[model samples]
Target: MEAFRNAVRMVINRSSDDQQLDCVLMASVQKQLTEVADAVTSVWPLAALSDLERRECAKTSAVRRFPTRSIVYDDDRNSNEANAYFVLEGRCTCMQRLRVRKMTTNGRNRFALIRDHDGHGQSHNLDTQKNVQTVYVKMSDLRPGSVFGLGERRSGRVVIATADVKCLLVPLSFLSKHNGSNIWGRTVCSLDGTNPTIEQSFRKFVVENRWEEYKKSLANDLFRKRRP
Candidate 1:
């Protein structure tokens, strides 16, 4: 019975010692973790920053690291509010149809109305639902045979005209420079032979300068304030 008591006492003492060792290990681990956290906090003071300040700082940094490219204008001409210049990237049947339609529609003062009637019902005039087509022209696609209508003239002798118009035609060469196509090295000019040398000079200037005037005109148009 004495031997049995001694064995039980030995087991109890070992268990207590193991528990003490576990506590010491746990305390050491906690201390190490606290030190790591303190080091991180010291190195990065992000915790002290306000949300707005952080956002602003991030924005400024982004702006500084990545600057935006400024658009340059070759000519100073502005298109009229209604006129648009589009670049002809490639030839297509749809483009031809659109150009023809625009020209035809521009001269028309009024259009005919068509309406469908139900059985045993009377048809009414549908003139209010006039089909007005919107045309999109890109800056790179303006070429000879591209037409312009009358508008105000601006700086750089550039005139703005609607692509859809009846009279007052301007040559494609006067408005844009040809990079390396049949239209290259040309400028749109007034059909009225006012100044041949000026037209030639303008083309030469645009080609030599590698400047793009139409883009500037577009930018100016887009940002221009509307008069009340």
Candidate 2:
């Protein structure tokens, strides 16, 4: 309960003084509150709020609430077009579903495993590692996942909307070009079961690469072919 209060205070402190309380802020608060609820419910299983907890959390975070609805979008890969829906039923601390509407098309899905590490001499300090939160996202949607690579075997995949996809997941350092362009550092790739950070090098990398452009090109190509 103390931790929950502190988390809420931290959130409130960070908000702008004049800013009106809004759904986004409420969502942030609810997420933190849910984290606390999970920790407490674990030890006292009988007190678990179960599905009601999730629904309440979602409602508290919104001005208006309704039953979870499927989000349909065209899939761009097959050129026949496809759609995917997200069903919000239950919630675990791991994946919290938020409702949103969008379109989709068919194409290949890609994944990248990114691992961040401390600088050469900074490993001894606890503060250096305390703030670390490692998460893997689908290259296309930036959705969190545990695995990377193709096929249903891999944990994360949202059908490909087009071809010409280049998925590269690296540390923020690499993405920000902090280590200089064309230089790749040793990082672990979860593609293989073994976690190894091998020193690899590259050139011509940008702070933000052409990922968006690549996705657009693939979508356009798929759309063109499907046109009669």
Per-candidate TM equals 0.21, 0.15
For residue 101, model 2's alpha carbon misses the true position, in angstroms, by 33
lDDT score, candidate 1, position 4: 100
- Candidate 1, residues 109-161: lDDT per residue as tens digits? 23221223436578544444446332222222223233322221222332222
Estimate every model's Cα lDDT from 0 to 1. 0.33, 0.31
Residue 129 of model 1 has an lDDT of 40
Best by lDDT: 1
Per-residue alpha-carbon lDDT of model 2 for 71-171, expressed as tens digits? 12212232232111111222111111111112233653222222232455342333343333322222323121222221112222222222222221222
Query: What ranges in model 1 sit over 4 Å off?
Result: 45-228
